[model samples]
Target: MERKALFFLDECRTVISTSIKKVLAKVGSKPVMRVNIGFSSIYVILAINAWTGEVVVSLAKRPNSESVKYFLRYFKRRVGSGRVYMVMDNYSPHKTKGTLEVCRRKGIHPVFTPPYSPELNMAEAVFKSLKNYMSNKIFYTIEDVKNCIKQFFKENKYRFNLNAITYLGLDKIEV
Candidate 1:
């Protein structure tokens, strides 16, 4: 029997976007800085089940082989028994030997998306929707952003019910 597992794995960074209040200035609104040099971004490493809409999220300072290993280990523990195929873009970290070894130990098969083809990954659309949802709000700190992301997953994790799309000829997308 074939493995009944498929997940889209990727990392995302949420940066501060200027609020409408700054755009519609009344000529003396303290001139909101066009670029806030001190603001930091929150990094998110996530895996989403395209079929069921389940999401696993981790907050990180940066995305690298270590984080990928962490995610794979966590994922393995969460779903104890299954053969899994993780689809992701060709980020340098995902290709690292350390990350590959983690996947191997966790019984996960890594499927690489085509080069320069982020649109081919299902996680890309999910990230786009996440960005659109957060675009209007201004976050003061990275922790604040992390909280918002946690809240989003808490609310939407069970609400996904969509058909998976296939882009490449690989036998990766099957119900």
Candidate 2:
């Protein structure tokens, strides 16, 4: 195990891009209201282990205490306690007493990124890079979108290892 901790965070998308169009893209002045298609948008909570460059992606609809609890439990069971550290962003549910308490009881120490610094969240960069890689690819249906994301993860898993080990604060294990 490495001396540094893993990083954790959750990503959720809403129809909120309508208002940010001007900032997010170069578009006409008229705001195009995006219709809510009522698809089951996923919330992904991911953990990146700094030692081995393993990226774990977990899906949820809501990021509440129970969801986080389950994520942590699954993580601990898979990785074991006291072997890895966790670096995380300060989301409310992540800061919940119940969640922190569970981490403490389970021997998983959680480190946090600095306030207002998304750059420190290397996982965010992974998503941004992947999306950019997928940009302008046409997909007519929701399943297409799902498959695109799946393919992105599959294609980048090894590249993710290289980046994670070199530039993303993860260190290679010395044998």
Candidate 3:
């Protein structure tokens, strides 16, 4: 059997406003955070190569079966011809018939993490890092948020370690 490349896939929603976090302020004085008044969100769909730390990201207005399938095709093109094993959460779009058909046609396999077990998916860590980077930072428009996300991934591309044995503790489990 040919060795398959491993990747962890996930989606994160980023808003144009900053995330609320505890801040150090003078007693009796509330910390002030200026935010955009209206709601604007973008979904970031990504796949992280478990061995190479290579990241592929796509932005969408919302995460749906069509968007997920599009990202899968994009990811397949980026990775070239190879059997891929993708670990992901059980998101509704990920299991849709269209998305599965795309996977089947592209030689991609989806392995879902157990319910309520986000930690099992290494992609969650990438999302957490992205959220932390975006926290306490105000963006006036969705484009600003999108640029920030793109910059974050470009700057920190080498920082991600998606090794399953290290992150999922697979090495400790006696097979």
The number of the candidate with the highest TM-score is 3
Higher-ranked by TM-score: 2 or 3: 3
What TM value does model 3 have? 0.88
Deviation from native of the Cα of residue 22 in model 2, angstroms = 17
Task: Give me the displacement of residue 95 in model 2, in angstroms.
Answer: 0.4
Residue-level lDDT for 149 in candidate 1: 77
TM-score (all chains, Cα) for each model: 0.79, 0.66, 0.88
Off by more than 4 A, model 3: 1-3, 23-31, 173-175
Better of 1 and 2 by TM-score: 1
Candidate 2's residue-wise lDDT over 142-169, tens digit each? 4555666667777867236534456544
Which lDDT tens digits does candidate 1 get at residues 1-175? 6436898889998765433332455766565444333357777888877667677778778787887889889988876777898988899999999999888888999999889987667676667767766655667777767777777777786345443644233457566
Q: Highest lDDT: which candidate?
A: 3
Global local distance difference test of model 1: 0.74
Instruction: Give the candidates in order of TM-score, highest first.
Output: 3, 1, 2
Task: Give the least accurate 10-residue stretch of model 3, judged by summed lDDT.
Answer: 157-166
User: Candidate 1: which stretches are off by over 4 Å?
Assistant: 1-3, 17-38, 166-175
Pull out the clashing pairs in model 3.
none
What is the Å distance of residue 93 in model 3 from its true position? 0.8
Tens-digit per-residue lDDT, 64-121, candidate 3: 9999999999999988987899987988999999999999999999998888888877
How much lDDT does each candidate structure score?
A: 0.74, 0.63, 0.87
